[model samples]
Target: MKLLLRRPQQSDIQALHQFFFHVIQDTYAKEGIAELVDDQQHEWELKKKYVAMDLESRGEKRFFWLAVDEESNKIIGTIECGEANEIIQQTIKEDLSYCPEIGTVFVHPDYQNRGIATLLVQKILTTLEKQKKSSFCLDSGYKQAQIIWQKKFGQPDFILEHFWGTNNHHMIWKRALPFQL
Candidate 1:
């Protein structure tokens, strides 16, 4: 399917919110953390706010990139570059004083494993490079995402043992910018 990658628009807020809810719900269910489902709406609202802020600011501090299916005109994936979250900053011990993070990388479950995420990441990296960034950090706490990141980025620079729970950890990877996908 043809995909279009572009900055988020005002009209895409609801769609992005829905995507965030479902993806997070699915992740929680898959990880057997069904209790976290109750937190999905709160997280979605925060993400929606962030998206709205990004749209208004026009990448002044944070930028969001959305991948839309050209055939159906539906948002299929997204990625963003912004100041790193506190958890990530503390884990990586950098505080994002200078290094922004590439995050919020998500793809619809039906469209995953189809290179949508890879495309979104590549687009975000290109945008960061264009902004003169030389490197970025990526973090993940989900098992499935951790596997994919390990494959794509090799070993992480920081691994928080049991950060989420016993046997569930968070990892952070730092990559030099302007590199190929």
Candidate 2:
């Protein structure tokens, strides 16, 4: 499917929230496992909070990029970077060079394994480079995301095992800005 990487607008708010609640749930909440203490309600709130954060981040400062299906003209996925991740700052041992992190990334379940997420990520990465970000980081606990980052970005520098006091663990993957190379 053809995809267009576009900056989000207020018009996309409703659809974005719906996609986050349903499609994103399958990606984030694993069967019988979660740092949300396996609490469905907690996960619901957390997801809403992230969506709020995305909505609040429009035009400058934090950037949010969404991928739209050209044929369907619907938002299939989103990748966001912001300057407010205390966990990543602490985990990476230092704040990035004015660059914060890849915060919330989501793709619809039906769109999984379709290379859509990769395209979304690459689009955001390219946009971040143009914005002069010198470093990048993203957090992952779910198995699929952890694996994806490992393959796309190489090994993580930090892993907090049993981070949620179970099989759950926090993983942080980092990358330097291309201009820094």
Candidate 3:
């Protein structure tokens, strides 16, 4: 399908919100964490907040990009870079509040494995480099996503063993500027 990658518009808010839930539910189910309704809701709320921050500050606080199907004009995927999340700060035991984080990378279930996420990430990295940002951090608690991130980013800089209990762990990666896609 033909896709147009661009900054989110005010009109795209509702569609984006729906897209977030669709992707989140699919991800939680795929990861076998479907029973964690509270986690899903928390994630949804965090994404919604990010979108609001992007809209209110016009990308000053957080920059977001949406992948829209050119024919359907639907938000099929999303990615953003902004201030480091609170959890990341707490985990790292340091204030990385000023650090830009690459987060909320999501793609519609129908669009997975099609390089949509990679394209969005490449765009964000390019934009960050243009903004003179030197480095960025990203974390993933989902095993599926951790595999993908490991492939693209090598080993994570930090691994919170059993962060999600049992075999489930959280991985965080920090990459410097001028990274190869």
Q: How do the predictions measure up, each by TM-score?
A: 0.94, 0.83, 0.96
4-28, model 3: which lDDT tens digit per residue? 9999989998998899999999999
Error of 1 at 114 (Å): 0.3
Give candidates' CA RMSD values in order: 1.4, 3.0, 1.1
Clash total of candidate 2:
0
Tell me which residue pairs clash in candidate 2: none
TM-score attained by model 1 = 0.94
In angstroms, the error of model 2 at 87 is 1.9
Quote the RMSD, in angstroms, for model 1.
1.4
lDDT of 1 by residue, 1-181 (tens): 8889988888888888898888878777887886875566676776777787798888877799899999999998988888888887777665465577888888888999999999888888788888888788889888989999988889999989998889999998888877676
Judged by TM-score, which candidate is best? 3
Give the clash count for model 3.
0
1-181: candidate 2 lDDT, tens digit per residue: 8888888787887887787667545754554443444564565565556656666755455567888989999888887777646677777676475766786678877787898778777777787888877777788877778888888888887898998568878898777776221
Global Cα lDDT for candidate 1: 0.84
Better TM-score candidate (1, 3): 3
- Could you tell me how far off, in angstroms, the CA of residue 15 lies in candidate 2 after the best superposition? 0.5
Candidate 2 C-alpha error for residue 170, in Å: 1.0
Enumerate clash totals for all models, in the order shown. Answer: 0, 0, 0
Instruction: Please rank every candidate by TM-score, starting with the best.
Output: 3, 1, 2
Off by over 4 Å in 3: 94-98
